[model samples]
Target: MLRNMLTRDELIQWMRTELPRLLQEDPAFRAQVIGILSEALVSKGELTRLLDELRAMREESQRRFEAADRRFEAIVEELRAMRADFERRFEEVDRRFEAADRRFEAIVEEMRAMRADFERRFEEVDRRFEAVDRRFEAADRRFEAIVEELRTLRSDFEQWVRFSQQEFAALRVRVAEMGIGLGSLGLRMGQGLEEVIRQVIESFSGAGPLKAARLVLIDEAGELYQPGARVEIDALVTDGRRFLVEVKNYAKTDEVWAFHRKARFAEAKLGETFEKVLIAPAATASAVALAKQLGIICYTFRAAESRETSE
Candidate 1:
């Protein structure tokens, strides 16, 4: 019988398994066990009081849980409202961004059109500038050509002017020689040189330093023209100034000597100093030399003209 009896752990295990089943399915057995436990742990009035306190605590816990649920539902509603507002604000921001993008696109399109037009106009202006540059280059070449022409003309003109000056100088010299030739020709024509000399002496008196008080022709009445005077001297005495004069086409050294002798003889007769003058178209260099040696001033047309005739 002892071997067939349960051990302490087996009895505990059986109670742990069967006690909840007995309480759930055996009403009479559950009541008997509850009565035994209640009587052993607490009296009837104490147990009744514990049950009442437990029921009040359960009802208070239930009310607090229901209030917590109500507060959680209100927080959920507030979160839903915040989410909706955020979504609406994000939509509004998207619409503003879309509008800004459209405006930017329109501005870009306008800028593209303006850039195209500017490029076209700039190309036209560049072409015009190129044309103007070409024209300026052509004009510069023309001006260069004109300047070269002017330089050539200036050189030619300078040469022509030099030639003209030389020709004119030669012509003037030829004309002077022809004038002297004409005078000789008049002499050859036998045109009375005495009358010509008379006119010359009268005109010389008008312009000479000594005006004529009277013209006494030594050839006519003076002792210089007496018979065998050895020289036919054409002489004039004016204002007591005696001048022995003669004219010839060409004078020689002997002719100049004869005139000097005539001057000496006239001085002897008139008792006055006489100036000797010989006028000729040309004379030998020897005749000019002798006249200078004899203190006779001679006037002639030759290279020695400068030495005798400064006036």
Candidate 2:
């Protein structure tokens, strides 16, 4: 019973080592042991049952292992495919990054060009402003020069006006002095003529069959006389109509004929005939002859008579 109840490893060892020994011991013993072993086999049928169960478990395990192996192979193939996809995506990302870099470089170059253009425009504007400032300065200088010239011209004009006024005043004074001198000379000549005529009339007053003698002088063409000259006789006298004396002061021999003619014209104007006498300090021979032919009396004080009268 103990032998039959052996543990599984022990029972497998007994079957391997002791089963042959029991058979070599006797034939009849072997047959009897075989019969007993058949009984023991009946009793130990748990081993066969265990073996069948093991076989069933092994087949199930093998099917499970093969299925697991196929699943692992499928998982490995998927991982390889995922690696290939990742490599392709990485290349595409690199290409995108390179394009973005080129665009960024282009933008930087455009900015640099804009900055250069702005600098050039600023310089041009500065130059134009400087030129405008210079023109303004020149205009200011010209205005100042014009003002200075106008001031000088005004000063000169004022001086010239003053000089002209002074000169005009001096000329007016000179003209007035000349007029006064001429007036004085004319007055002196008139006075001298009056004195001589008065002396002659006094000398002749007592002589001559002339009882209350008359004196007359006439001036014709009086307009021809010089300014301030006396052409009219200073004295005129008249008695009863028997005789008429015409007296003239002669400064030139050429004037004697003119005087004689004027005296004769007066006789015709008097409307009554009368004896005529001419009196003068000097007369031409023709004047004397003409007087005689007309039966006109003439008189002059000789040097001897003049001296005798003075003594």
Candidate 3:
């Protein structure tokens, strides 16, 4: 019964140790155990039944083991397929990694080439800039030379200006001396001309227009002459009415207007209308016009030319 309860390895161990001890403990035990087993043995029919049950159990267990073995083989085949799929995917991943590494290497190489090209171009630009700097230095030297020439020219111009100023001052002094002499001569000539005109007026006596002709200096008052103004008349004559003549060396329009004002003042003072005349060496066109507008006769006398009258 204990052997039946034990596993195959446990049953072999118990028999190896315990069977010899039991035989030594009882000499007749073995025969008695055989006689009891013989007495307790099943009949032939019972033994045949037991053998059939055992065969049936053995067949069942074999069938079960075969089913388990088939299941294990199927599981092993599935695992093998999974492992092959994993290896194929891993190989694809390795190829992808290699391709990416190649692409990265290409990019790095391209960048290195670009950097080297840029460095070379920068060196060329630096050389160009150096050449430009050399040209600027040459231009600066030329500019300095031009500046020096301008400074020399300015100095000469300043000296010329100073000499011209000195020469102008000397000429101005001579001109002033000549002006004084001319003034004295003009005064003498004017006095002489006045005397001559007085003689002419005197000779004109017993004439038609100049029957009572005489030269007189008038004192009068107007814009050009205040009260008691000393005014020189070139001739005081009677044409049908009184006449006042003005004598000038050179007559301009302003002198004509001034003489008209004096005539006005004289007319006011004497309480009589008088004809006005201007005598000169030469009169400007504007002076002749003004004299005509003012009803003043203008006469020009030159030794080399004919005596002209403003009609």
Candidate 4:
């Protein structure tokens, strides 16, 4: 008959109870079972040893895997730190570049402003220069006008001087002709006076000749006379004053008796109280001395002759 194989738990329980029972009931079977059991125990010990070895190998593999995992984590942390450092450095470099760009842009703007300011100043300077040039042109025009006016004035002055010189020359010629005519008329008048003076002298010789004679005459109504005549009159009058007259026309005398006679006649005409007698055509030194003693005045026609003479 086939016996039932024990279940794992039931076989473990049956081997504990039945193996002891079979040993008690059958010695030979008990010995064979014991030997098999001993063999099974040996096999189980070997399996336990193998299992422990496998568990030790698994623990060693886990330890090695864990260590490798920790090393990998450290390497990952290092890589992350390096990546963070690189990113921060890149950000700093970018910020610096941005700041530099802003500075460069500001500098460019400043340069543009400077250029504009310079252009404005240059334009102002150009305008000022243009104004100066205009002023210079105006001044030049004024100076030219002044020069033209001066030239005109000089020409007028020269013309005036020339005209004045011509007028002066004509005036001088007219004056010379007037002088020559006056001198010729004077010579003719002197030539016509000779006989009239002789008649006057003959009238004075009559007895009891007047103490004074008055004759009022205009310039051109006199009778004509000769160039040389001498007349003595007892009395003559001019402006109501009685004077003894000795008329002379181109007659000169140095005789002292002639002047003494004139003074004596003046004394008789004035009743011995006459101051002087006039002797025309002034006498020489001896005549002047006698005239001085007898109280006679003497004059000459030389002044009238000088007036009639031509230059």
Query: Which prediction has the highest lDDT against the true structure?
Result: 3
Question: Candidate 3 — which residues are off by over 4 angstroms?
Answer: 1-195, 198-223, 226-228, 239-241, 301-311
Error of 3 at 101 (Å): 99
Candidate 1 per-residue lDDT over residues 1-311, each given as its tens digit? 53369888887888899889999999999999999998789877888999999999999999999999999999999999999999999999999999999999999999999999999999999999999999999999999999999999999999999999999877754554454445446656854334444344444455344332212324444445565434445445354455666665677788888778767766765687866767666787778899989978676656233333323
Q: Taking the tens digit of each residue's C-alpha lDDT, what string does model 2 give over 1-311?
A: 96778998999898899878878976887899879878767545688898889999999999999999999999999998998998899889989899989988999899899889999998999999999989999998998999899989989988998998888867654443343334334435653333333334445564322233224334344433443334332233334434455554321223444445545555554666655555654445555655666676655321121211111
lDDT of model 4, residue 165: 92
Cα lDDT over the full model 1: 0.71
* Weakest lDDT window of 10 consecutive positions for candidate 3: 299-308
Candidates ranked by TM-score: 1, 3, 2, 4
TM-score of each candidate structure, all chains considered together: 0.32, 0.28, 0.31, 0.25
How high is the CA lDDT of each candidate model? 0.71, 0.59, 0.71, 0.58
Candidate 4 lDDT tens digits, 173-281? 4543343334334536654222332233334343223344422222232222232333344235332334445444322333345545545534544465443443343
lDDT of model 1 at position 196: 42
- lDDT for position 165 in model 2: 88
Index of the highest-TM-score prediction: 1
> What does each candidate score in C-alpha RMSD?
19.7, 33.1, 20.4, 31.1
**Model 3 local distance difference test score:** 0.71
Candidate 2 stretches with Cα past 4 Å from truth are 1-44, 123-311
20-130 in candidate 3: lDDT tens per residue? 888789879877876887788986888999999999999999999999999999999999999999999999999999999999999999999999999999999999999
TM-score of 4: 0.25
